[model samples]
Target: MVRTMNKCDETTVLNAIATCRFASASDAELLDAWTRDQLAEAFATLVNRYSVMVLSVCRRKCRCVSDAEDAYQTTFLLLAKNSAKIRHADRLAGWLHRVAQRSAVATLNRTAHMSEPDESLGEMVVIDNPLDEIAARHEAIILDEELAAMPERYRAVLVMQVYQGDPIETMAERFQTTVGTIRGRLQRGKKMLADRLRRRGVVPLIAISASMTTQVSSVEAASAASQLLGMLESSSIPPSPPLSESLLNPLLVNGRNLMSPWNLGCGAAIAGAIGVLLMGPAEGLVGASGGDTVDVVMAQKADADSEAAAVQFPAVKPADLSSVKTKQGSVAKVEKVDDPEVSELAIRLKGELDRVSDVSIDGTVESLADELQQQLGLPVLLDKRALAFAKLSPEQMLNFDSSQEPLRTSLRKLLDPLGMKATIENEGIVITANPSQLVHLGIGTDRWLSVDDETMRLFTEKLSESLKLQFIESPLRQVVSQLHESLGVNLMIDHRALDDIGVDDDFPVNYSLGGEVAAYDAIQMTLRSYDLELTVRNNVLLVTTMEGAEESLLSRIYWLEGLALDGNFDSLTQLIQTTIKPDQWEALGGRGTIGIGPGERPSIIVNQTYDIHRQIESLIDTLRSNSFHPQSKDTGAHKSTPARFGNPASGFGGGFGGGFGGAGGFMN
Candidate 1:
């Protein structure tokens, strides 16, 4: 009877393993001699134990419910395939997590088609006996209340630890942060949880026992663990969180679709003008080929070179002696001997000439023509033989054409040069001229006067000082102010644009609040000011300001627009009204001043696209300023995925170049 009981227990354990594959090293040796049917039974045991956890991981990381389901199945499939290579059962949970994570990321990169968070969950389902289920259901309500109320960072740490049961090391690894940081997060998370429970009139059990390495020891943490188990165990757990939304759903949609509300609205209209005629499913809108556009613009400029000869000046005419003003104060004949294109006859008068100060001297037709030809160094044929008999050349016979008055007027200036007698005091007054020579200097012509080397050096110093003063009165101050406001977060704003010259970094602006605050705090304050609350997690920013504040998701949308277009308040408002779902508006702080709902979260997820959109919009603005049209989809080709052993990971989309992953630093 004892032997039979032992056999029964063994059989039960083996049956569980077949269902879940949750077996340790001891089971490995037994499985070595087991048939295929026995191995399958062992795998099943492991599955039954951890399937719930695996599904949760999949939902958290994947694009859609279907995707998550697929991922869960795939993980099991992989386990079955690699049964022979099984090593330790204790690591199975971690291995399963890795598999799911990879699957989620892979699916997102390949086809990012996740729906928005389920709206159905927002409306409470009617239960037949509400009072009977109230006790068990109340816990879920409390948990939700606590979670929704907690700071985003703390909540994130709690979720990862409690619901996911992820090891501290794994959390640290996932966030690409240190164990110390994870510990810090866990400690703070525990305190916040305790505080929240106290607020609910529940005396929270909270303690931190010392552990050897990076490990958290809290009674509340343990309680949280038990609550999680309870929630998972009961499929009908009241107020179960809507299925986890996609990680990539906040950025890209399936194919060329951009997940942002504003993108959907405007992207449709500007498809053609932005270079892509249509934004079809597979063939998303693409701008005019960049290479072709560049070539066409260059070719247009190159075509103008053929017209240069038409503008070339005719051969210089000899001075007509008949018009020479011989009564001169000084005949200071200046000569340029290099090419001798034309000879200057500077016959300065005693004072400024009466009507037309400059004059051209007419000489003997023949000798003048010869001198003109010799000076031009080009052969010219003269029409007059009498002029030729005096050794005249063809170049000298070239006369100014007055067919076009403007051309005639401009050409006449070459023959009739300005003349003046040198005064004793003005012996070396440098000639004033305007040339494109100073373009090589960094200053642009629009904002700066291009001067010669001597003038530029002197002007740069003076201009630099003037700019310093002007910067103080400039709108750049407002830009910086708006930047802080638009980010909805506190930043170490580097006010060094004119700091060294005009304002120091410490010099407070009108809106400056003396000291810095955490970005989360600042974001919270900003959202509250707009009657909203922001919630942040792993780069996801959720606006959970109120029940009515769900409408403020519209404002959050405005924040996105503001961020994209450098705080254009008008655009921000318009985008909000256009992009947000009507129901979500109530969840965001709606149209009031600093409204707060029960358990409002200040900031939840950190939206990375806020930065990306800002950059793209900045680029668009720059392109417009430079008179170059920008394409709509600035995102490059290639999607983001993990690296395989044989093939390096490659981006596979038409957007930001970087792949999807942790920030790989504390800063993320």
Candidate 2:
């Protein structure tokens, strides 16, 4: 979340919030939370800004008052639920109008499931005028529906003239068009709306069919919501949120000194809003309990769920995970049992691994493995992949002893004799027998990386930065530099690799992607045709060929233990190995190897290029998030699933174009 409140204070939010200080505070702008207080404040401003328009929309479509309240709450609560996905701040009205109407419909649908409906919630007016047989609220709903779909260029003019009460001449100045153009657009937009309403079999009301000759004021007597529809600053309103803040509140006046209790009450409301909206892993944890701390906890949980919903992973079958290798260096075996004893075995294993005590060892690799499992009570085994590389067998003798240290440290010492290390994978201990002969394994160095590295820490942040550009046949260097500028990363071209691959720095490129794309994926997408990939060295991003990346392999271990409990661990590793960079894994004639860890929660030891490692990290992080919040069937069409790159292919369907895409330029 952003922190726009940092620039201004409560005094500004309560008093002179009308000046240029907040002139550009769009709905998207106020959705950030650099600090917890900013999230509270920005959300408060958004609620106060849009409550009227949203309420009016809700009141129009929902027949029951309770349904209206539910719709209203859902509209705002969903806004807070998917705050990060609000890419179009200027069209906040359009977004709200659509969502508010959809929410009203959803609430009505939900009410249909009730044993009995409340008939007294709202009563429809029976007007006397023949031309106005339907209530004005009904008419507004029909017109608003048509207006929402119209191009902003045309519908915006109509809204300015009708809703905000801007004159034709004034609108021309704001739109940078002539008075005649404004009037023509206004008349044409109205006629189109009238035609649409007619096609829907909605009988004409003078308020809808009349041309520019009729003013919105003429229908004031017919509409119950007429005052709110037209240009009228509310004398007073409760501080709340919905849609159409700036669109309806053109003057932006009457900034109130929100009472101290307002924050407390709003905090409760905001907390309840999220609690009612989010599901999945956060199913029963959300609460409306009073406290700033609860707000932070609930909001953070919601944000994580939101991110989980944002990333999409392909479906994999459970059987696909069956028949893989079981705990350490055991031969490939089919795992076929529920094993009611799993919890007990897991506790025993944890106790063995966590024990900090003296230990001694002297035996063959087979004997060492046996000691780890049968004696120490750890579910230990060896990985054949690592052993195959090291050309070592379980019969090989090994020796080591330890004093008052973790069992894990002693296990490493035992494996250290040969170039292998131990990891917990596949619900047991996996002794990964990697080549210890090489001083550099593309790990924990400028050539390789660990999670502790600053660059590694910034991996998620840098990849999440959006990149959009439109250039026809631009030089490769120019495109690379442009991406560097957009992503704010230390991106550089690998000239040697480019030359070795017989590609030129000025290779003419004709590509256009006008939609949501993270910079990491964007780099891969633009360079895919040349067989290029990204790698890191000295904490700097390097663009190199897939061949260059393979020359110097790095090894990193991923603990997928708790992350993939919802699905098969082996299938997850297979998904990563096969799809992330299909050609690079050892199975595909490349240097990379993904060895399954043993335990209930699975893990994987990967030896690949750094860039590929980063991609794996993104995938696991996304999957972990989405596991908490499986997508909902109720709001399928309107669910906020913004494009966030996890798998390398997240950008596949996003390559749409009419103009330069903007994140910095819109498929989404």
Candidate 3:
């Protein structure tokens, strides 16, 4: 017996609903009128009733007003599209709340930029206190754990009351139970949640009331609702009729007059227009004279379709250099670049250094350098002053077999006391008088350099492949020295500090690692006996006492903008762990974690060195660059999932340390 509004305008209809007491109509009644009678007023009434609630959810989840508004529109649009699927009208509010949350999450995932649209729109400033941030994270984790541990039936009722703001009557009807039963379930759910939270040392009790409330005005809601309804009505395409209607007249197509040729042509034209709109503007839609040409337009459209069909999708494939071979009748000679050959030689030298070999040499530093130069076919420069300063006997016998240990380890054992270190240079391997001098020659920042996960993995693999080790009670210095030589990594040992701790070069280290264990792991095993640890400082490895290393473990926070929006948290975390040193992460333990903030920006929390933090930031930058193009090819095989790292051609050389030469050193 309700009267419909005569006027189609939003203000008039809203005024009519208010005056006629239609504003207070139940959602079930409004939905019935809209679905059964196709009454525009009924649809408008539903929108007005729930728009404020939807807006509140959006505002709470979104970073800015603009994003919230987009989410708001999307939520209601989805509700309208799926109206027929609503089986329980009384639970409509709860359903809408879920939809609003999903809409906001989807919106956040789609947009990378998360800045406040306008400060005047009441954007909340996030506090940047470390203690507060940690507390909030712990509270959220504890709450989730407690809720998940609760019984299903009790949990459901509690969620309905607290999160969805459903009345007790609505809950009873939804569960098909008595009011007393619903109240009992709510009470039990609350008590169980409180007990769990208390045991976990979180809050003593859970809040039963809804945390979020609608701050939007009735007038604003009415205006937004009216606009949404107008969009739906003016779509120029009607909603599909019920299955019953279609079944009754299977041959009769709705929205067109099949008997009239003109009506049929108009329908076809409308369909074509919709296709064009969905696909974006077509080429040659309008002629140069600002008029339409049917034949030319159709030809262009046909061409576009053909081109789209002909385009081939990129596939993961391996590089095929064999295809460069000439046909039987042709003769072609491939020319190699001298620079590339030199670079290849350097790579080979590193491989050679990794191989386990016996070294039984009784010679001076100069003689050792000369022998290495001749064997490796590369220049080996020894500092004369460094040798003189060491005051070693001219026939000092340094006899040891690498026995699968890294060449660097053997070299370090030979040269450590001489106040000299060997590093790869553009010219050749230079046995320099000062280790600090070599740092100056490296590329990028001396303090910190970026190394990707893939590069780190490849570096470790290469090191493992080159090394062949079997050690049973080897000197600690010799073990570390061999590891350093094969890896070409700078290992700075604090001898003075080690002496104070009653540990020295002859400290016995025992390991049974055979085959190709990772050089990093081998080094760690050797250091474990002395209670020593390794930390990276400006790309140099510092093998020092654990106490000294602990001083560098400082907590830092970094804002990883756009990472959460990309929706690749798992991939990103994996990439980080793979790229960074395993020992460094282990040292951080539970302190190292990444989380998506309320505003959708990802934040990294870790206790690490400043250099390590810089490296992480670099890796994050690389991830952001590859965010848009997620998939990558490898060895002709199509990746089942997007690559954790981008194209190898993008460059992933260099170790966790800085570049050694112009060549992308182990982690560059």
lDDT score, candidate 3, position 406: 47
lDDT per prediction? 0.31, 0.47, 0.46
TM-score of 1: 0.25
Worst 10 residues of 1 by lDDT: 293-302
Give the number of the best model, judged by lDDT. Answer: 2
TM-score for each model: 0.25, 0.28, 0.29
Kindly give the stretch of ten consecutive residues in candidate 2 with the minimal lDDT sum.
658-667
Model 2, range 1-668, lDDT digits (tens) per residue? Answer: 87665323433344234323443455445655411334444554555455555665666666655666666766665565555555544345455655666666566555254434344322333346735534455567766665554544445666555544557666555444345445545654565555566766676464443211212222221232222212112323223433334222221222111122223234455444333333324211212222221000000012222211112212223463233322433222222334332233332333344346565767876666677666554566655655655556767776677887666556655654575555432245555532212112322112123334556658658877776756687987888888777777788888876665356678665567888677777777766544567876566777776656666566666643213132234445556654564434544334578775332112467778877877777676565444433111111211212222122111111011100000000001
Worst 10-residue lDDT window for candidate 3 reads 293-302
Instruction: Provide the RMSD of all predictions against the true structure, rounded to 1 decimal.
Output: 24.6, 21.2, 25.5
lDDT of 3 at 27: 68
Ranking by TM-score: 3, 2, 1
CA displacement after TM-score superposition, residue 660 of candidate 1 (Å): 39
